[model samples]
Target: MTPRSRPTAGGSTALPGTDFGHLTESTRPLVELDDAARIRSIRSERWIGYPQARSVLGHLETLLSWPDRQRMPNLLLLGSTNNGKSMIIEKFRRTHPPTSLSDREQIPVLCVQMPPEPSPSRFYLAVLAALGTPIRPHSRVPDLERQALMLLRATKVRMLIVDELHNVLAGRDNARREFLNMLRFLGNDLRIPLVGVGTRDAYLAIRTDPQLENRFAPMTLPTWTNTPQARSLMASFAASYPLRQPSHLASPEMTDYLLTRCEGTIGELSTLLTSAAVLAVDTGAEAITPGVLERTEYLGPTERRRQFERHLP
Candidate 1:
């Protein structure tokens, strides 16, 4: 379904031309798919190796290869919610996936989510769950810890990534302190680097414990701005989609409008773009034009929350 282009008035190009040169070579063929297929392709998840994500991945690699030491270095990956912190960690984990040996599996990188209700027992349960161990209901905290640590050592996990770490603050004072202590104990016992991923609150929770605060170097993924890097990111996104014609999303005017509407978060920007791309395909626009974006049903995060509040009983 290649688009056809015709000369317009004043020597201008017409809409919906087969000028998919803007896309990556691998993605160019997708432009020929039917509208439903192209929309499905557009909705699929993909990675954009922007500079900040690359830098974070580099740091994760360094930590993964660090030699065993009494005080292993840790990292605190801080970012706004839905700003790509978890995506970066997932990408790193996939790069060094687990290896199954004759006897046992060797997990080079183990990722666990911090329990919403933070407690040592619940945390160890999360670890055990991630390791694919059967949970014993009503298991004692000590038993859970023993099992978790034993399995961690047996698997030879090089690094542990704890996502949603800001949930640590959800506990009471004593519970929080206990969880912090558990973290220190886990790191010291396993001699493996612990990476914490969450919002700024996670850093604050770490700061409460001086040792953890010192060990974990903070790295942040701030929201996007009207910068060259952001423009490049927009161009990358435009190329990733299977649109037949150029989106011109990297144009300064479009960049400004996108950043403003998406409220500067990559997650919001992605949602907005995906919705607009779907609309573009459905309406035969073949490119994400201003009209396509305007017709999308997507709403920015703030607006969605405000709308929700308005409907509250």
Candidate 2:
């Protein structure tokens, strides 16, 4: 009899063959818990598929299925930090995760982070690492390029997703140009869709090369505002929390309060809700309320930074 190997997610043992599916380790174990335990369970990280994200995911599915063409289709997912860009990409990846085919594991989508500084060496290294390909640290550009290209093709990667593409904005002009050229060359060489996820600067980065910009269509996820859809988003999100009573998180005052606390980003909003829920659990409230929100450790980005900055003199 052969033993089965379990997967690791966030360092916890996961069921064999489980691909870290949408339900995170944080929220998966509370299938039948009371409100208090549910609050703690609901505090886990989760995916909230708002309208824009669902539409973007649908477009990504189309791109992945696109037949190979001279000018391969690509996407530039532009949005503010913590506005759910990465989450959308992550959901897409999970949907088309690696699968074994004819003894070869085919990674339909490959997601990698753009390096802090844009350099060909770093770019190749990141790709190689994603593929779990070991390499000599001092390998030359040509060797690394050949190695990366071979692995990408062998893995049958249909889509390459690069997150935090705005990091390229930090590189110098020559490096930036080279990086953009590399992107164009890769699409031409591999005939695979390239999905770039980053802040709005990522669109600007792609635009630097008119040809690349033309090849990749732009998709934007704007910051949240007080709207019916936004309120609905809040309500849908709040329903998932384990609370004794309905939170009414989308009520006028609550909506404004959450928006301000989240700094208008869905990611921050999610974190704030998690924190508030957890605090409520600790305090026996079991529901998110203005009092619970006030007691939460959650802090908006600007305010959090301001706190640290104030003590630095």
Candidate 3:
């Protein structure tokens, strides 16, 4: 028999065939590995694309190609914490990576996290830091602004993505107003699309400024529910793992249980599944069975909060 047809301990062949038809084409080869290797693979990070994420990526691509005008369009990517906002941006950034020319580096997409307590100077500093420029201590706000704008123009940044944008609300009223005005100035001055990413509070903050609210088109990534799409996502997750046997995670009963336990967030669901897959590999289950899920150690968001409160002094 050929090496591809040889049976492995996980009851799957080394390559794509009848025995490994349940898995993704790329994952089929992983099933033939030993338990330790399979466990390592299960713990590694991977992306599981879904419809919503794909739609967002498509929008981002459109934004990237938008022409520079007096009033460039913008996007507000709103979602709960631990949702896939950052990952989507990261993926987009990777797609259009920085180009190193003989003269200078050209960064088409610039992503920076909003300062926790945002001020004009602090925000400028964050931008400078993200661009790998050295910031002089005790620099004036005007100086910082000049440096940031110069670098942004020099680097030829096409899109600016500000993550944790809700942090703008953390400032006092005057500070918040100043920061919002600064955002407006940046968009107008650079004439590049600005993308804000944060929780719903980001939307609320933007609404306070009518001009910004109108300029930024809002997009949301809501929590998952028990539906055909959710089941399909679960099936994709199952197939991505290198398990020897089918996980059957898309069954109606299993889907409901998983969603209930995960509190309807893809991040938590991924955590739970990763743990279960690890347990499955370690315990010789070779699959994410119901029993394996039960044995897996995980805490849903609400339960974790309640447990923390219970232990409070």
TM-score of each model, paired residue for residue: 0.94, 0.87, 0.94
**Clashing residue pairs, backbone N/CA/C < 3 A, model 2:** none
lDDT of each: 0.91, 0.82, 0.91
Report the lDDT tens digits of candidate 2 across residue range 67-134: 98888889999999889888888889999989888866789999999999989889999999999888
Model 1 poorest ten-residue lDDT run: 9-18
- 71-154 per-residue lDDT for model 1 (tens digits): 999999999988999889999999999999999999999999999977999999999999999999999999999999999999
lDDT of 3 at 209: 95
* Candidate that scores best on TM-score: 1
Q: For each predicted model, how many residue pairs clash, with residues at least 3 apart or on different chains?
A: 0, 0, 0
Order of candidate numbers by TM-score, starting with the best? 1, 3, 2
RMSD of 1: 5.0
Better by TM-score, candidate 3 or 2: 3
lDDT of 2: 0.82
| CA displacement after TM-score superposition, residue 35 of candidate 1 (Å) | 1.7
